[model samples]
Target: MSRRFSPSNLFLGSLFVLAAFSFDQLTKTIIADIVMQPPRVIVITGFLNIILSYNEGVSFGLFSEILRGRPEILVFTSSVIVAGLLVWMSIAGGRLEAAGLGLMAGGASGNIFDRMERGKVTDFIDFHLAEWHWPAFNLADVAIVVGALILVSGSFLSPQQDVIGK
Candidate 1:
């Protein structure tokens, strides 16, 4: 088998993708359907709260107005991105890169599923301080961000040969 398709790399990549996707969907379902039936905010800590939100657009609600009635566009675009991420993961130079790409792919998959089923993405988990409140997001979003950080930090820590083989 080619190095890009090594058994270990494929296993690790698939594992992260499945795990991230499952966890993200489970959390979203529980939080949005079971816990927040009435759609009210629940305080979790000094800076955290659970509040349900349906985002009709991309990250941070950008272009929401323009995409208000066009969910197919978001779904199509996101699906393409997820496919690209999976392709990258398959050829990832190291475990960290594979895991990061898998996570991003999984998160994007979850959002795509949501958009297809509900015509919007379900978001919750709000962070705030004083009067300033960050936009609400979900577990999938967390996975994507953490995965990105892992990839970045790994790049800085690992030797050049580890990333691009000698």
Candidate 2:
């Protein structure tokens, strides 16, 4: 009965969460099990390539030395973040904000799943310019970043409507 618990909001949140989560997991599976086997690089373009790598820590391999190969810590941290996002989405106004929260939750969940199943996150998307390169990342990371951007931008753009409207 409450506005925060409206069926429409729940539907939109569920739709985006399911979609993002499924896509993230599917892409990871395909990259890890099929495309990257034999551990060789696959070039997609001059600027893009696939070379599988495992991340034992958070974004950009930060805290890899701090975690020291303990996946449980990452799993717990990700679970907490995802839980917060889910609660935030429940009360968030508008489909745009809800979708953003949903995507964040889904992506976080996918990475948490990875930490649990493989003891690390599987990253395969590689971007480079000749000798210059960026750290490898996966689909879940993309979803989380874009979702956070959308959520933040939507809040600033719509203010009350995006965060607390009826």
Q: lDDT for each of the candidates?
A: 0.84, 0.83
Report how far residue 77 has shifted in candidate 1, in Å.
0.9
lDDT per residue for candidate 2 within 11-94, as digits (tens), equals 787777888889989998998898777789998999999898999989989988888579999999889988888887777667
TM match of model 2 to true structure: 0.89
lDDT of 1 by residue, 26-122 (tens): 9999998899988898999999999999999899999999999899999999989888888778777787777888888888888888999999999
Give all TM-scores, in the order shown.
Answer: 0.91, 0.89
Worst 10 residues of 1 by lDDT: 157-166
Q: How many clashes does each candidate structure show, in the order listed?
A: 0, 0
Q: Which ten-residue region of model 2 has the weakest summed lDDT?
A: 157-166
